[model samples]
Target: MYDFTTFVQSIGNFLHGQFSPGVATALEWTLVILIYLALYAILGLVLVYVERRVCAFFQLRLGPNRVGWAGTAQTVADALKLLLKEPVTVNKADKLLFNLAPFIITLAALTVISLVPFAKGLQAFDINIGLLFIVAVSSLGVVGILLAGWSSNNKYALIGAMRSGAQIVSYELSVGLSLLTMVLLTGTLQLSAIIETQANGWWIFKGHVPAVIAFFLYLTASIAEINRGPFDLPEAESELTAGFHTEYSGLKFAFFFLAEFVNMFTVAAIATTVFLGGWMPFHIGDWAGFNAVMDFLPPIFWFFLKVSAVIFLMMWFKWTFPRLRIDQLLKLEWKYLMPLNLMNLVFTAILVYLGWHG
Candidate 1:
């Protein structure tokens, strides 16, 4: 097996040997930042391409087939156009917050991804309260939306932002509770610990019905959290003319676009980590031969495979479901998901206490 941790340590040692300790540390930090920036840009372009191709197929039409072979360079070209376009300045907008909003959202997305365990020793930050940290940081995106809407001084933008605030606030409880149900089975908040506990089997298998229910609740709430279709009241183009970002243009608008894709990736990655088993290969009890065959593949491969499955599911919902009314969205969360989630949590807790859950 490839020792990823050792590889990272070797690079650090080489850097220290080439420079003073402080200089080496500074360089390491710079490299990490640059790597994450590159990752963010790459994910945005790749996800956009995947989304377009997937939706086109759903609609029985050809997607981006121009620019690069099979339309691979289409998103790249679009990104370049956004980079070169001049940002429109609103005469009466709050300059400080209007400009600052996108960075807040982009920062939240970047920061939360750091805590996810992509594979063993592949995580950037493995804090003890990783799960809690994710919940807190992910909630910050709504603040940016609110600021963007309010600062624009447009009623449509403000209404869109207000809807986003309510939607995120209501659905966030379901997301948190569903995750909490998993925490009961794992008995730890550390993301790495959660994956390690799943070595025997994933919670979705070991924890049984509650885990399955939690997984569904997580998906439903997460879809709403990221503002994907059916739950995308915040950016309803048909009604709000692009919603909270209506007043933004050029690079500013690009930031919001990038943030949405990044948020989608983050949501799916977290789901992969929590419910599906982060990078852990599947194994049936006492089946050494089968387990060994599964282990032949690398952990990173398993991690990405699970994440992609969850992403595809989200995309499927977006393309297939009709948009929900603001009232309907709230009612689904409060009246249905919340009550069911509470009962599921209690049931999971009993299972954990009785030693019925793995």
Candidate 2:
């Protein structure tokens, strides 16, 4: 794999050569931290704006066009508004936890961004247990949601949080199984290895039927896990009245909002890396001309294009489908998705064992 982070770090070391080794290392880390922060800010804002525009398009309405050119800065205006607004505290709420929940969730979402390989060499943290770290860190937002609901002293909030917890916990199994399908095929847990294995062809193309099934399963489970509309019981406003973050206001609310938006990107990035081939260009066998055409574009462009495709699919689900009832939601996962996941995992394992995988 190309090492973009190392290149940047080396530049930092060279620039700070007069300083001690420890100081230069610290400076290198600081540069990396700033890059991540910029990514969080830019990507978070872009997702929100794009989602709104997509929803408006689906609804046959003109989206935000007044704030800036086609309302590109609408989310930025909203963020500033949130920043200027005062945070209100609920007297009956658990003060400490209430204040802590937003930051915790936001931090959880931000942490996973470091592990995703955006391009050939543009990864921040490339640990051996990369996939496990993603799964474990991705699940941390649930704790913040649970705490927010509990601290709010609001029945609606509590119910929403519990629903979110149940939903994420159940769907996580399907998501994991879907990912495991690829892991079994590739015989590796490292995300970079997974991507490289698909260099000749994406897993969806290579694994055929079972991989296709797992892809869809991962798609559906990811949407539900993130609590987006159609699976958004956690924030079912008609029922839960704003859900777990109901009592949160101002900057605190902004934090939760940022976490949710960024989480969507995080999920989409995972999908791109796992199924579509992270930073890998489309290559067709024995089609030299076509392969060269595909390779002409930069790797980052290919990566973003794939991520956007997945994100758009997620947005399509959010806008087109009706929110599922809690019972129906649980049933869909357990009775349908879970069964399919188990069968698919077994089938994939069998395929690998028989040496039939392409």
Candidate 3:
């Protein structure tokens, strides 16, 4: 007879013997949470500086140079200022939910980081359903946005929240569809498994035309999902006066701002994992010498390089494009992106069935 409990206990005992159970558990959870928090803080500062520089380049002007070495410390200073500033609650607003919303948004952003594989074997949790876990946790940000908007008791806040809810919901379908194509091709939903499948070649290359199309669809859907420019109808400055966070001041507002930048990197990381081969290095077709050279570089470097390129593309979109109207946004998603994504998934399935992948 199969002793399921004993079998499970044996496995647990094995793991405990290999790694001190109490210490390993504590260290693993701590490292996961700390890495997530540290990445947000560092990336938030870098992105703010990069955005200013990029915007300045486009406008033909010098950007922030007053603070520590070309305004690198500007975000840090801004963070300190926000921390010192007092938070104000509107008279008619739901105080608890209103205050809780920003924290919720921030937490949601951080939670998705756990599933992201920074390098081979570097992921915090190698959950079998890692990809699905990410999608589910990321969607929770919408709830936070809705709560924040509704609790503010401001008309603009309500409008922003409603727009965000609709926009995120529509865009999420395309994102999911794009990911489904990858899952179908790889035959597993685990992030690490997806990367290993791409060891011989990146999915964007291996899966051919369908994968390429899915990549673009994923990019567009991600931009919309993050509520970045073009799809930034929720925070339309001209109309909503800062949108859902209009009534929030000081540290509360800063939390919302930080969440946006973190969300941007989160999307970029997902794109890296799905399409660009996570931390897999470049390889030439059967070229052992070139592949060996590529392997010398750390996995984290490849992961960062891919993610940074995606982030730059996003920043370019933000600075270059004018915001789209809400209705136009929905029309683009439903009429174009959805159909294209579905077709890509079908094509990917055919390729996988035919063993055409590299």
Candidate 4:
């Protein structure tokens, strides 16, 4: 029965079963938007909270304990502070672009949420070209960044924006390759199909060393893509004093900030789905007892565990590695990851062709 010809038809079947087709269809669309919006807000709050606690753990300091039990409410407070502030504007800045940029970036990130599969039957849309769509949509945020920096009419902001543009554009190559490496093995570009291909075991396990390498490669490039910590040259405080967003304040600034944290979740989710089997629980071939134990846990739990592991690793990099010089950052991408990824893809293709992937 789950052999859905299309995701839209699947939704229609479920909605029609519940109520009048007309009302159910309208309700489905309305609820989907609300859910996505709630998810967007919740992602920012949860990420900020997690990042603070994780940061404190590394620094040997108590984080936001005073705000709300163990600082749980700290992000909530921060959100309120931003929401209440007056948006400031510079006279010389291009008001139109400055105002439009944050929305563009935020929308780009939000659009990807609908394309991801959180669970087997849970997703907004399951398109055939999910991978290509995600990559394209994910890259559109750069335009907003460029506009934000340039429109601000501040040289520092402009420089920061340019740096961010260059960094994301370069690292995206590695990200694509890292993902394509796994796709080569799985033989599908569909996100849901890729996850299903790993029903027996995660790619990192079945595909072995090459898959492991691609995972790390993707992780590093993702860190740079999100502009976090060491790869955060675009917003280097000591250098650009907040960089491209220096002129941003209030809700506008919040949008940019929200997008960064949400983007972190986006990459982590993609990594989880590609490398760790999306919402599929782990299973070891021929290990009946162990497989049963794994199956006892919900698929969503397995998915979260994998994504959390990836997110924690990213946090570790942020807390440990010092910011790389611009030259070093670019070199790491071009001289290192790019070559490694290409070679890995070729090798992976050979392995697939020989039926040796498992």
Candidate 5:
């Protein structure tokens, strides 16, 4: 396998040898930030195109097939329009937090993406407590949403914000618990170590029913957490107008919109790392030829393949299901997902203790 880490290390070494340590460090960090920014922007555009085309496929429509080869440039064009529009401020809005809110959510999305392990040496932040870090940082986006609503001084916006706050807070429990189930099997908080443990087989295959339950639990909670359809009470068009970001327009609105797709990607990437084996390719036992073929693809290829699969599943849920009432959404999480997740965790722990999970 190609060692991307070594290649990156070699670049860093060359930079250090060419300049003072502080300058080299600063330059390296600048390069990293640039790369992440490019990725963040590119993913936002690409994902928007993907979602449109995918939903169109489901609805039997043409989607974005006109602009720049199958509507590839459609999102870019829309982004430009939003950028060129005038940002209208609410007459009575709190200027400070209202302006700050978009950055808060956008920052949260960008920060969480840094923790994901894209390939063997592709991760930016490989912290010891990466899972905990992700949960904590990702939750911060709600605070921004709440602030956006309250600072806007709009009733509909406030309502949307409150709904989002409640939804994310409640569903986060299920997210943590579902990931914790696999933590027991892997016994590590590091993302890379978790992937390494799955080199033989993914937890979904090895941990049996409990792991499967946890995967679905995570999937369901994550959809709600990101405020997708079915659980998107915060921005339900029939009820709340534009929801938490109703007062936002122009670039501010674009920031909020971009953060959403980025957050979706972050959630899917985390799911890939935790439950779908991250960058590891699928391998059947005692099938060297088949395994070798799977291994022929790069780790990054496998990683994004799994992530794309998960993202498509999320989009399917959005297009297929009807939106849930707020009460029903909360009930589904607190009553069903939460309890089932707890039981699955207990069962997984028992299996791990008995050495029967394999």
Candidate 6:
């Protein structure tokens, strides 16, 4: 059997030896950034198409299927249209910051991917502080949103930006606290190490009640953080008319849309990594036959499946729920989720101390 750990280490070592330290680091970062961009493009296309199909199915109507083999090329056509269109800048807008905002938001969305582990032994940095780095960087998107809104010099844009800033800042605490419970149980911040720690069992199962509660809290907070559905006051079409990007058009608008989709996937992927065992295949306790069957599946498949499931759940919630008022949103986070997460963390710590986990 090929030793996967050694293979990953060998690849890392080879890259290090093949280039100077600076060059190697640059190359690694370049590779990660490129992957992030590529995935952002692909997922945006796929998600748009998928959302259409899902909506059609729910409404019992036919979806896009005429463009290119069941409408597969529809997104491609949309891309070309956007590329050919001119980006319009609003009157009195700050030209420099107006143009810079989309790039900043996109970059912030892409940066989070570096810390996400796609499969066993497959991560970009695998830094000891991977979890914290992701949380910190992911939150920076709010700055870009605020900049976009303020720079537009439009009342609606300013309102959208303000809502986004408040929304993300409020929800991020719950998300961080929930993830902290997992880190405490696993005793590591590296995504790879956290996954490895779950080799025997997923934290969701191994940590029992606390893990379950944290998972739900993480889900709720992530929804608000990404500004999806019920929490999407920043872009409430009925209210702010496209939110922070109200004044943006053409490719600039595309950048914001792409970043939002990528952010959604990133949140789902992180949740899978922290609580759902990431690329680790499902296995029952000491079931050799079951494990053997599970092992036949590649690690990436497991990782993708888990992340996809989380995305579907989010989408379901989005379609089924009504938007919350800003005050209600904050109250849910601070009054309820924050306190509950604190208790969950303490309970998890006690469980760990009591030798309740594997």
The lDDT per prediction is: 0.91, 0.89, 0.87, 0.89, 0.92, 0.88
- Where does candidate 5 have its weakest 10-residue lDDT segment? 228-237
User: 1-358, model 5: which lDDT tens digit per residue?
Assistant: 9558998899899999999999999999999899999999999999999999999998999899888987899999999999999999999999999999999999999999999999998888899899989989999999889999999999999999999988998999999999999899889999999898898899888979988888889999988998885788888889999899999999999999999999999999989998899999899997999999999999999988999999999999999999998899889999999999999999989999998866
Tens digits of per-residue lDDT for model 4, 1-358: 2322376567678888999978997988898899999999998999999999999999998888888788899999999999999999998999999999999999999998788888776778789889889988988988888999999999899999999999999998998899899888888888889988998888989997899999999999988988886899999999999988999999999999999999998899999999888887778789999988878887767778888888998999999999988999999999999999999999998888889986
Per-residue lDDT of 1-358 in model 6, one digit per residue for the tens?
A: 2236687677658889999988887877787678767878998888777767766766688889899998889888888898888999988999999999999998898788767888766666678998999999999999999999999999999999999999998888998999999998999998898998999999999889999999999999988998885899999999889999999999999999888888888999999999999999999999999999998899988899999899888888887788998899889998999999999999989988998877
Q: What is the TM-score of each candidate against the true structure?
A: 0.97, 0.96, 0.92, 0.94, 0.98, 0.94
**Top candidate when judged by TM-score against the true structure:** 5
**lDDT digits (tens) for residues 175-221 of candidate 2:** 88888887888888887888889988998899879989998999999
Q: How far is candidate 3 from the true structure (C-alpha RMSD, Å)?
A: 5.3
Q: Per-residue lDDT of 226-301 in model 1, one digit per residue for the tens?
A: 8996799999989999999999988889889988998998999888888888999988899889988999899999
lDDT of 6: 0.88
Off by over 4 Å in 3: 1-24
Model 1 alpha-carbon miss at residue 249, Å: 1.3
Worst 10 residues of 4 by lDDT: 1-10
Minimal lDDT window, size 10, model 1: 1-10
Off by over 4 Å in 2: 1-6, 12-16
Clashes of each: 0, 0, 0, 0, 0, 0
User: Which residue pairs in candidate 4 have backbone atoms (N, alpha carbon, C) closer than 3 angstroms, thus clashing?
Assistant: none
Candidate numbers sorted by TM-score from highest down: 5, 1, 2, 4, 6, 3
